[model samples]
Target: MARVSQEHLDARRRQILNGAALCFARNGFHATSMQDVLKEVDLSAGAVYRYFSGKEELIGAIVAEVLETVRDVQECAARESPPPLPDVLIPRVLAQLREVKPGTLGNGEWVFPRLMIQVWTETLRNDELSALMTAGYVKVRAAWANLVESYKVAGLMPEDVDADAMARTMIALAQGFAAQVAVFGAASPEVLRDGLRALMSMGEPRVRP
Candidate 1:
């Protein structure tokens, strides 16, 4: 019997992952069963199981894939000669959040924002997923902190600016934007960009007292 090529194996793996993503995105992690995924992909249970032992593994893979995309965006920003400011970087990140991957529903809707919200909730009950999310958060925040450091070095931000604090703020902003998008379906990257610009243009805040 001829052995399957590595490319063939990888494609099959991706096919399963994509099918699982669709199922999870539509019905959610808890509602999506391995059998549902097997049906979605039109593959035998054994074929799907060969790639993932269970739903949790599939969810982990899908979450990791999304985080990996975010990491790639952050890494690209870090490579810039002068890293982008919050207004620029945040919008870029938001735009990425709106991206529709292959496994996502193709109804011109943003599936990732909703899927991610579900994943965040899952982390509360799943220790392994919580750990995975924490690790991914740390890495992404570290990348943002590095960008903050670069801004300080470039004299764009004040010397006393706290990189970690700024990084946390940026992450919060991005997550909040995603939440809004997930709930309202009205938030746009351009709106976020304009809001950030307006806030930055206000200069430092002062107490009215």
Candidate 2:
């Protein structure tokens, strides 16, 4: 047999996960099974099992991917030299998610966001998934809180504002937008940007120069 490159291994893994996502999106996470994934990927049960032991494992992997996406955005904030403006960071990250997760609503909708929402909905029953998602959301909220604190220090935010509460509001808005897209269809990037602008403007009153 020809040597399988690391690239090939990674591709195969994604291929299986993509198939699993389709099944979960169509049937919901609790209803989807390893057999469904195998059929979707058109791969042998043996081949698929090598990557995931069962449906739970597959869903876990997908959940991890979603968490990583949020973490990646946080990393951008922590690493950037000047860091992005609050308005820019919120809309930009939400827009990126909207762009990347195309056809998740199925009919010409994105996939990633839909998959995320499926897992999120199922989290109501799955304690394991619930804990994982909750932890990820907490980390993301903390990162946003820190970002808000930075803006406050730079005199861009109001002194009396609560960084933690404001950050939660911002993140909650973004999360709501993501859920809307996953359930309906993709929204215009301007919608999120405009919303963020309005939210952030509360802190920066317009000055008549």
Measured by lDDT, the strongest candidate is 1
TM-score of each model, in listed order: 0.87, 0.83
lDDT of 2 by residue, 1-209 (tens): 99989999998998887778778877787787777788888999999988899988888888777666766786678556566875678677766654433334346666765776887778999999888888888887888887776776766668889978987887777778778877778786578778777765675667889
Candidate 1 residue runs with Cα over 4 Å from true position: 1-3, 97-107, 204-209
Residue lDDT tens for model 1, 1-209: 99999999999998898788778878889898888998999999889888899998988888887777777788888778788878898888767755525434666556777787899899999999999999988888888888888888888889899989988998888888878877777466878889989888996779798
Error (Å) of candidate 2 at residue 42 is 2.4
The lDDT, on a scale of 0 to 1, for candidate 1 is 0.82
* CA-RMSD of model 2: 3.3
